[model samples]
Target: MPGYELINNSEKKAVNEIFDNKELFYNGKRVKKFEKEFARYIGSKYAVAVSSGTAAIKIALKCLGIKAGDEVITQSFTFIATLEAIVDVGATPIVINVDDSLNMDVKELEKHITKKTKAIIPVHMLGVAAEMSKINKIAKKFKIPVVDDNCEALGAKWGKDKLGIQSDICTWSFDNGKTITTGEGGMITTNNKDLSMLFREYRDHGHQNNPKFPRGRDTHRIYGFNFRTTEINAAIGIEQLKKLNFIVRENKKRYNIYKKELLKIKHLKLRRIPKANIPLCDCIIFSIDDLNKIKKILIELSKKNIITKNVPDAIEWHFAKYWDHIFKEQKISKQQLETKFLKSSYYLERSIAIPIFVKEELKQTTKKARELSQIIKSFV
Candidate 1:
């Protein structure tokens, strides 16, 4: 319940329109329109709509030329999707510690770069922003392309620009819980024409936008996959994008309320959200120790039908250190493994996300939040 969603006549009309139109099926009709709107929304030259955020990351990595033997540098504490995309591209993920900013430690980056370090993926974990300025400067010096894993940070900002614009390639999700939704979908944005062309060709099964081989006919220009969005999803996305600004504004109000109410419970410490960044604030999160105590509080809260997540899922998968699959497969050195324990647990294990969804029935959400806070206070 810690997510925000608002749907009305627009989504219904979108679905009906798609169902009525037998002429416009899925050959990039609605998908292309949504992509154009999304690209314009983020001020990017191009956008390639895909099946999910994971697909966007996969293609972004492939477009960056990361291969099986290459090493990709990314934040240690993030959703497993970041690591999944790295391994999907056959690239070894070199996870580094997150500093107080709750992002990849830029200081640790230079030491990890080598002949094998091909690219850097700065995952903007949670709604909070990652430190892209310093990371980008270091990346420019080394000439390694920075692919922003901006899935969790849609509609987020840093300074005058949006989070995705600073990097070489950026990805977004319109999943059920993201700031925007098309049921399930993703988009990749970039300023580079070559990369844009590659993304298009890759997404469309290497067709190369040729007249000779149309939809029914085929000529494999390059190896690719069917990571395309349907007309139904794109139609919903187009309508959803229209309401994004208002949605963000309303959700910010809800987030502020949560922050104020929860801060009164001082023992359950809340992290100071960064000033330079304007986060989507889709889900309210806080840090707490004593997992058992937190678990007990959650049980009490759930009795009232209130929901909260345990440290962004679990301690093992939430933090990269305990990723047994990557640790076994990625060829992480002994030194990197040794340094993992030395890094500070900045946020992941110590945090819990509370349900703060956007609601038309505002009184109910607020009342529930207050009740959840009181329940949590009792445990403390």
Candidate 2:
């Protein structure tokens, strides 16, 4: 359900405005406006735009002073960028298994906590929100910060509020495949003023943005890096932000068509969604208890030219169990990695995630869902 599908004159006009001014660099006009709009939309005090979601995570970690010897805990089912950012900050990534919800298993969270544990990242994988209340409670008990990775679950909700605004620091991706697309960009949101300022400076190479001085004479508080986004990306994002509600609405309609049909098939367990979660409806996933049946369903789907989302198709990249090459650098053996993520493997292997397109016709979606159900029913 990428916003790229809805790209039209609105986005073209926004980009054109940037070209009209001939100011492509993000000198806090378009980028700052996008940040303000996004923060207001999510009900957060502040937002910092960055180069990409990976950069957002890295900047948040840096703002919190996470460094060597410190461990950051995240779910095994998350994208590798989560782990990559932790490692990039010179920290150890402590991966924990996900439960039926395909999110961090809160029950196993405390077991991984230690003196070195500096941050806990609970990723709202796919379209559903993780058990944020439970995860946040656990993190509070350990006195560790929580970085909500709402990259894949943008526009999703936990209880009454939006996903990213409820954590110590939240990160989002506006990449090509995301709910909204900016070609490639990211955002970090937080209520803490100090952390917000740090994120702003850290992403801009430590520039304090002093009103009295020019960019050449801007003072620095600490060493930073360039993670800035161009005005074109931000301008497109501003237009995309206006269409968020429409995207979510259409996604829900199509997702429900699939869900309604799938529910009629006995023994096909849908991915476990927590009661508090109001998903973005961008994707629907279900697990088949029989591995052979799962394979057959996939074959049938392939025959129809329908593609599954990340679950089985891109599991190798999304699941940490297959990241032995990365763990090898930390002296962790392949066997150890597999053993740690056994439960995650069990749930993810049997699952099939279908992408929901915002522009797809409902009748077509219903026809496909019925076809999909029949294929699964035949296997059962």
Candidate 3:
């Protein structure tokens, strides 16, 4: 249920207005406006727009001064971008296994923490929140900062509050395949004024934006790189943000249809969700012990022109077990990677993640869910 499905003239007008203003990158008008609205929406004191989610994570790491020899812990069930960002920052990624929720297992989290562990990133994969309360408590005990990788769970909630705001720092993605889209962009949200100012400066090549002078005479607080996003993307993001509630509501309706039907199959176990969490509902995942049945259901869904989100369809990119080719220096062999994440593998290998669409009618969604359940029933 991405925001792209509900694209309308409002987005077009926003983009046109950007061009009509004749100030694309200099003024930071649309970017500022989008950042303000997004901060208000997420209940954060500040929001910084960046080139991508990876950049957001890297910036967070940079702001915290995480470097070589420092250890950053994340779950094995996340997109490789999280690992890549940690590696790019010269920090070693200590990947832990996920629980039934397909998120960072808090029980296993502290076992791997060492004196070098500087940051812990609990990724909310596929529109569900991680056990933030537990994760935060552990981080507090160790005095390690928590960075919630909320790229996939933008509109999700843990308890009554938004998922991202619970942690020390949260990073978000507005890429095309998310709850909302800015074609390709990201954001970093935090309540710390100093951290927010540092993020803003770092993303723009350390431009302090001194009021006394122009861009050419801008002052710098530190050496930085360019990770700035355009006003065009921010303009579209504003429009897309307006439709987020509608998308989430529609997604829940469709998700519940699948949930109700899938529950009829006694053998199929829905992915474990925390009682306090209300997921984004854009994707539904369920695990079946029989690998053969899982494969057959995927084949059947394909025949019906239905596509899965990420569990079995795009697992190579999402799961870290297949990323040994890139982590040679970290001594992560493919076999070792597989063995280390066996717990995560059990759920991921036997799961099917079906995507929910906002544009589809509820009746059609119900029919599809029934058909999907029937397909699973046949396999069972």
Candidate 4:
């Protein structure tokens, strides 16, 4: 879920747009406009709409010609969708450690590359940008393509440039929890014209226009899956895109409140923000040494009807060890990044995420934020 429910004029505008033009329910004008506007917003040559972020990644990988036995490198800490997309397309995920910024460590890229490494999928985790400059620099050296996973950090920037254009192809999500939601939808952005055409065809069951038939009559050019979303979602996306900057600014405002109050607390270690990147967050992440202490605090918070969630278990779905299903099917030649891995596990297990927006349950004010911080310090 999003940190809080958002009520805005843009949502009303979305409904109006959809209601005004409801005839073209599937693959219609709204979807087309949203794609164009989105492309322009991200400064990409093309944007292909898909059913979900997972579909966006899958299509990008497919267009890149990644197949079975191809190893794709990505962060060890990210949403499960990133890993599942690679596996769904018969590719292995070469999990790498996240640096101090809790993103894919660029320094470790060279050692992970081998003949089977087809692509690098660096995830922008929790609205934070992974070091794209160094990651792209290394990809350039090896002549490998990168599938930028900008699902969590859509409007977030890496230096002066937007996050989408740094890689060969990139994806953004519009599901419920993302920075901006389209109910259930995703977009694929790329500067490659030929690849964009393939993406267009791929999303619609490989249906390409045929001169052999008339308009609205097309034939399958290649085998493709139907991951097309509806016009209503696209319409919502169009409106949401307009307010992205405001939403990002509001989120940053709330994040700063948490930072100001939490900095005085002794036991918590906040995540490091990358130097050149502007990340938007709905929650503030902090790492602690004792999971048991956090559990006690979480329980106490729940008693007061304030929820503080435990960090995602890196050793669970996000970690490399928990992915036995993917690894079991892999070739024996796939080697480990390290024989012993605990640092990633340590951070994830002891980490905690405090929601910045708690809806009407907790008024979105600095005073309430300070209260939340005190409650945390009191528990520790």
Candidate 5:
């Protein structure tokens, strides 16, 4: 029943400056400036700008040398982009289940590790960090790298470490719905110089170094792709980064309001994340014993202009066709695939991400949530 708006005048002005200055290329000054600003915010030695979050993941995998026959362990309940990135790098995705927090189940990871396993991608689903300590220990034991998919978790922290600060390589998205928007952009953060170089080169068509010269210059170096983010996007990103703290504070405030209001409805359940974690999005997941009745109620709410959505499905559904090909190619038994792929440890059937943003006040959203709660209770 509430409303949401995109970036305000301050963000618009930054975008205008990029066009006014006529700097549109990735190698332009605006892009460099934003990269520095983002790296400082994320506390990483290097940040490579790319076109999108999916591109960031693909480049990170490439920089890490994840290739054909490599098994990359990841959760099966994440965005398809996460799995697709692994597959793009010619690596076979080793799907695992998620825990109660909708993060990679550490126990399931060890069972699936093979000699071909090269890395583990621990996604900070809904902004909550996976059990990174346990996952990192396992990765260290197996000599596998960790690439954190932090697209949905811009300012999330676990213990004392920031989400992207502790991994071998971390990726972030600046999509329209994320905590910050660069219109369409992404960033890859890492401390490894060699890996950073690889990502930079890959983003700029395999140029051995910076290519800011005239026509027909020596630009091509190693094998790469065109995944570069423009200065215009980076300029918008710089402005967004400036308001990061404000955005995070408002999101947390809204989450608390939702928690307070939803608690009054006894039959409704909310998804649980660890107390130590800070989420990127406020997801309310519930399970109704009578699915048809709940669907009827939802439809009625929709007629009243109230929106809702199902939480993400298990990864198998999102990547079913891919898994089929993988299973047949590897000649793995159907039973093995089921055990490895079909079982999702944490599956919530009814869930929705209520609106939250920096410009909105918590009191208003809380009141709305309480109103919705009352309607749901009437049905019970």
Candidate 6:
């Protein structure tokens, strides 16, 4: 299998510096610096660092006053964290279908809005930006806020604006697999001062003034959780931020290479992205009537040490069997807004994520992807 590695010694040196200083905590100066750097990077007024992407979403929901019985509409075809964050904030997740690009279907979003609807979390799936202009217009008509789940799309843009700048609250992830890595960290960006302050408090355990003091000693402004990002992680993030533009450019280059090579095949279908947007990952998906055949081919590739696996399934259906009781109680319904829900079906058994990272690896991976596409087309 082609190897994939997410770390470089250059990043390790930054993390080492923080550890040398013993600034392992997530409070005070280190966190502030990371937040400022990230905010500037995304062109947002404020950025709050959190332990994970889920924490960032939960904090955003809490700041927005999303509570139990409240409904938050989001794409069905996303990571479970997107829906889980809604549930974490005591709001019901109303799953909406996605377009061909694997983003929330803006036209169908209006159907899900109701008296109980509180917000819309548009996820930029597989690094592709959602149709934010239309989604924002729909949210405005209902007077609901938008929490952009841009976990997969850190450097992605919509028109001239960046992802987080266009929404009320935009959350990003820096997990090991993301475009950028901070080991494990997330960021919440917003222009709303009140929301930004609330998020800071929420991430640090709801302390009013002195976060160091015991719970009852200081003012307990609100109920909160310990979702702060560590200084070590922040340091790693600081370095990661420096390389983000380079990483995004590399990912895009790899995407184009795959697109150029694979488009020649008749049966394979690549994910579509607008020329203006920057994709987060090169996720190539296609349709196949026989899933077992695809699996067999992937296994054969695995023997050669080429890692091939299906794309992830939609959060709703993946968890349906386990969470059916809660889903039924909440009255969550599924909507299909595309000719084929390729997002879910592609994830089920047919699609695979080809290796794409650095320029050198990307070249090799792109060549392999085209070769694999030919292998699959032969079956067709």
Q: What lDDT does each candidate get?
A: 0.79, 0.91, 0.91, 0.78, 0.73, 0.73
Weakest lDDT window of 10 consecutive positions for candidate 6 = 312-321
Predicted structure 4: clash tally:
0
Per-residue lDDT of model 4, residues 183-270, tens digit only: 7899999999999989988888887756698646787667788988778888788877877776777777777877888888888888
lDDT of 6 at 280: 61
lDDT accuracy of residue 174 in candidate 1:
80
Note each model's CA RMSD in angstroms: 3.1, 0.9, 1.0, 3.3, 3.6, 4.1
For all predicted structures, in order, the TM-scores are 0.88, 0.99, 0.98, 0.88, 0.86, 0.85
The sequence of per-residue lDDT tens digits that candidate 3 reaches over residues 112-190 is 9999999999999999989999999999999999998999999998888888999889999988898999989999999
Tens digit of lDDT per residue, candidate 1, span 6-49?
66788889889876877356667888899999999898999989
On a 0 to 1 TM-score scale, where does candidate 5 land against the true structure?
0.86
Residue pairs with clashing backbones, model 3: none
Candidate 5 Cα deviation (angstroms), residue 290 = 6.3
On a 0 to 1 TM-score scale, where does candidate 1 land against the true structure?
A: 0.88
Rank by lDDT (best first): 2, 3, 1, 4, 5, 6
Give the Å shift of residue 179 in candidate 1: 1.7
Off by over 4 Å in 1: 1-4, 211-221, 289-305, 310-317, 331-346
What lDDT does candidate 5 reach at residue 367?
69
Candidate closer to the true structure by lDDT (higher is better), 2 or 6: 2
How displaced is residue 376 in candidate 4, in Å? 3.5
- C-alpha-based local distance difference test score of model 2: 0.91
**TM-score pick, better of 1 and 6:** 1
